[model samples]
Target: MLPLESRRDMKIYTFENRTIDIRAYSSAGGLFTALAEIVLNKGGVVYGASFDEDWSVVHRRIDNVADICHLRGSKYVFTDINGCFSQVCADLKDGRTVLFSGTPCQIAAVRKKFGYHENILLVEVVCHGAPKKEYWSLYLDELLKNQGKTQDEIASINFRDKTKGWKNYSVCVEFKGGSRFIQNHRDNLYIQAFVHDYTLREGCTKCPFKNPNSKADISMGDFWGIEALAPNIDNNLGTTIAIADTAKGESILDSIACRTYFSVEQVAQYNPAIVKSPSVPLDKPEFDTTVKAEGFHYAAAKFLKPVFDSRDRKMSFRNQLRSFIYRVYSFIKNR
Candidate 1:
């Protein structure tokens, strides 16, 4: 179950940005850019996730926009948070205004590590969950092999490419020679598995931070149902939903270049992840076991076999409770 403090009390907004060169992973409405602008305006360093050479996501810090331009989009994999918290603490101790952006749990960990620092601004993304690193690493290898490309030839990868518009977004990958490969999410087997809730990390299935009230100053995510609620808003590119959880968050939001504040209910109605955890698929354990015994491709084939099968459906309350108990027991046993 989610923590009660994270249940309600938030201010929503629609944000957009057309100036920067849009990347594959960047969501519509320039939400991250808006947050980066705040750090820049305050002469602060921005801490965000960046992809490593092997396509793994790692936390990084940047002081200039040009250097941090690639930190725009989603990576969809478990991020390496090593050194990020310590760096933020060191910077804040030196009196720097640090904007640390990541998933809700990452922000929560940082908050717990530093306790309430006035100089630190925590911004969490509305997350579906971090997919397993091993699965993603294997999936990328398959893509590279299918394309006949070497790892060194790859320049960048974007999970939220908007070439086909926001709603039908595709994954975009660029090689060093400027050649690009774009795959619609629907056509990608790995993405299909991810969206179906098969490869997600265990912690995400029972997220404690999946609530509106946040320890961070602000929370942001894709404003999914923008077209239905605000007909005037241009969602062709994409729209961002920013929720202010603190006075400082609200104050910083008012200064963003292009944003319009709206009621909290507008966000809750569209994105259920705001109030409750996403349902875990029934075949999750089998999916994990198959991935370990066979390969990602084989496991994906098994996962795609049928949609109506009972084992593929969401877990029941009894199962969820049992899983939680097992997780707690395992944690204690490991300790």
Candidate 2:
């Protein structure tokens, strides 16, 4: 029931020019990296999710600006906070500046635990609910098995590889031996699981942090439909949609060196998760059972069949319409 930007001073923003390398490494525009860089330049530390050696996403801390790349991109998998809350508290207690970015739930916990600390700035990713870590593990196992690789052979996993541009991003897996597996997002089973709600947590089906309730100073997400919403600024690469809830958030956004600023009111039209939780897929129960017994691919096969079928049906209809129009033109010309 809360308004989108409940605060009178809340503002929206998007990158004007382009962040070339930054956008390439990021899931969206490199706004998080920019914000972290600002904090680091001011002698502050940043806490956010990063992949560990085993590729499990977990919250980590870094004070150096160069390491911000490690924190970029989207990890749909669950991220273990791993006692980082206490570390943030320690930093704040010592009067050190801190920039923390996480899912709404994590940010809410930080806000509750730290309580409007002057030295701490809170940022939250506009999340579509996190999937279970176990699901991600299973998917990774299947991925490595299919690629004829093992845990030791893998170098890195990127859920959002913007090489083909960010709109329809790819899931990239780099091997230690120098080969890479870059699968289109449409074909990525893990993304399908996350998007279709098969792997999302039960609580995420009805998330508690929608709007007018978030304590985060800034909320950032991929502007999915920016091309249609704001065609002039659309680069077909990655563009970030940022909502600044406090003056501090606005100040941090202003510090982003080279970004064009613009406000959007209908962001939810593209990013629905901003205002509501994605409903649990009806087939999730079957999906879970199939995945647990057979594997991720097996479950995906049975479920994704409908998606392919729908696409085929739509294509067939379009083809039929085109043929009909051509025939009609031929008849008129002959007459």
Pick the TM-score winner.
Answer: 2
lDDT of 1 by residue, 14-98 (tens): 6776564542346756778867876877788999888876778788999887766757887888787867877887898889988
Error of 2 at 101 (Å): 0.6
The top-ranked prediction according to lDDT is 2
Q: Estimate each model's TM-score.
A: 0.84, 0.90
Write candidate 2's Cα lDDT for 227-260 as tens digits: 7777877777778888776667776677663333
The lDDT, on a scale of 0 to 1, for candidate 2 is 0.81
Any runs in candidate 1 off by more than 4 Å, and if so which? 1-9, 18-25, 257-262, 307-335
> What is the overall TM-score of model 2 with all chains considered together?
0.90
> How high is the CA lDDT of each candidate model?
0.77, 0.81
